[model samples]
Target: MSESPSSSQQQPAVGADRPPALLVNNIEVIYDHVILVLKGVSLEVPEGGIVALLGANGAGKTTTLKAISNLLGAERGDVTKGSIEFSGERVDRMTPNDLVRRGVIQVMEGRHCFEHLTIEENLLTGSYTRSDGRAAILNDLDMVYGYFPQLKERRNAQAGYTSGGEQQMCVIGRALMSRPKMILLDEPSMGLAPQLVEGIFETVKRLNEEEGVSFLLAEQNTDMALKYAKYGYILENGRVVLDGAAAALRQNEDVKEFYLGISASGRKSYRDTKHYKRRKRWLA
Candidate 1:
């Protein structure tokens, strides 16, 4: 239910010259030969802007990210219809590695870092596809380190030994190594402290403001997600039920009640009391 702004009322007040960086049009996904996971979902991410896929659990957020990243295979999952285009190049049928090579990377949920490798080694793995990227990789590492300096200090330490926030940074740094035009970030704040979630969101902001990297992030952390994103689409029952500017969604009472959740205290409690103070020691 994306609110289509009329020609006279375009949001964020964009001009007519530039096209969207990523365009996913009426895509359908099915799994296990019979079950449908996505129902003709369509969306767009303008270049250098943050767009959020906002939803509760089981709302097709991850599925939408996976689908656009061309990680969906028929044997596993299939985009039965529609197309995904990046800068006007058709990409939905491509392989995951191919997509990465073409500068499309997905930082998956749960901070999928290489547990056995050192933080430096884990970050280096992100540039595996680049043969002579050592110098540029170092620069990128420096950039990521500058954003989360904790990673720089713990560069040579074992990735498995780091805390959740650091692991999330490593995963994001790994994706950035690919020099992606747009990164598909799935649940960057799924399981972390509130402060760390704020830090991660700030880093995402810094990236967009400084490097002009585009992002399409899916998150259940609606309060933070809408804050980080400029435009948002709310997913429900495997379909987009609401879409608008982040500021608009933020003020929408129904969105706050149903999707974003009424109690911000729950988010704060899980972050402050549980792992917030304890996890930062090792991470810092």
Candidate 2:
């Protein structure tokens, strides 16, 4: 009932069976020497696959990204413990540029494009590491433009003048110019309209399918994230509480009720339904 991977498709997953694209082990992060933001979080992204980190606000999802990118210091939060391995190398202590050189690029929580620069200038900045410099930079720009043609038409415009959705495209395209193997997408659909959300997800899917770029996406748009990713990890209050195959998690009654609202059990748990409560409250 299923087709196994073809010979050409048999590379490695992020773990032992086949080395994953990225491996984030039991990591903890803290700020102010007391406030822990990430509590022993662990997840991985297999090569060319998408992994979603889902949770409510304040769930530590963004902190997890900052930890992986070593960008936590901007806010004084440090990766207090644990390690990150990317493509078989220990990466936790590396600088942001070092991580980018290692093919791990983060799009950041706010699509932080250079607003004062023209769209093309902002994109050229993404290829700062390339030896070919400006020429190769243009080639990468073409590739990015192919994905978001609207950006091409606005190439001469100041990035800040673009609409929110277009600005998001510029940020992602800027990251792509770095030619990364995997990307840490903070929240591509955060403030987008439903129509624009569909377009962004489609572009992400295309990039993954056509370019073999792996992704570790952290998003509150659970529906879209789950749609594109193969596996998922759910976080709450600084810890992961649920993780599994995306399809399995999507159908989980409790997950549907609590996260997606596809079930009517949101008011009560399977363990303490009315039937059980009537008979078992005293047991507690």
Candidate 3:
């Protein structure tokens, strides 16, 4: 595999002055006790900042998120190396519930809402880890509605019947109900219309600005992810191949040619050249 660019060749991490909300330090993941999935991956999401984890499918983005949220156990995956920290506390070994209560939540990819539950009920489930009593949960429920007015309209409707955009809203609104300090968002734009995708990203920006909720967004939509994220890390085959501030990454020639489908010659097809040639160029 190609090595990531040296630190001197890249911009400093975004919000480096601020304390990090979540830190994954040189971690590795293995599934079924045999197959290695992540190779010494490391990144940081600063307090109240948005960072995008950009990669195509199977590039290990979701696995990285799962490792941070401590959700790998369900899939028989284990973090055999390195550690993860949240709010200055080591949380790699924490339970998923513990992580949620510690203000870390993951809205899993594919909008995993409870099909049998009403939209409102589905949202209420997010508050299950809170012990701050009913009043605060109800207050946050209303707060979620304020961010996603569409959910408020369909509060009584069954989640299974809701539109894909509405389901996406429901899941994110659900995460908000948990009052997270940092959210590991997986593919917020999947299966949505372009307009809806933009709308979702706009709401994410608003949440970051207004609520001060940091985000580690794992997404396949490189263009949209970079557009909204202040900084980004690009993963390939279980490793971070590139990382930088959003504007810098947008202008990087390697990024433009590969991820964004643009080159100095003009827009190009990723399949126009052999995969190894592309890898060799990145390695160079």
Best by lDDT: 3
* Per-residue lDDT of candidate 3, residues 1-284 (tens digit): 35344433422366547877787877899999999999878888889999999988898999999999999999999999988889889999999999999999999999999999999999999999988999999999989999999999999999999999999999999899899998999999999999999999999999999999999999988999999999999888888877888999999887887788877987556577433221211111
Q: Model 3: residues >4 Å from true position, as ranges?
A: 1-12, 267-284
Candidate 1 versus the native: TM-score?
A: 0.85
Query: What's model 2's TM-score?
Result: 0.87
lDDT of each: 0.81, 0.82, 0.88
| 10 residues in a row with least lDDT, candidate 1 | 275-284
Task: Indicate the residue-level lDDT of 209 in model 1.
Answer: 88
Candidate 2: tens digits of C-alpha lDDT, residues 1-284 = 13232323422323345457787777899997899887787777888888999999999999999898889888888888778888889998888989888888999877787989999999988887767667777887899999999999999999999999999999999999999899899998988898998898889899999998988899998888898888888888777777777898899776676678686634655667321011100000
Report the C-alpha lDDT of model 1 over 132-216, residue by residue, as the tens digit. Answer: 5578888887887888899999998999999999999999998888778889999999789999999999999999888888999
TM-score of each: 0.85, 0.87, 0.91
What lDDT does model 2 reach? 0.82
Q: What shift in Å separates residue 146 of candidate 3 from its native position after superposition?
A: 0.6
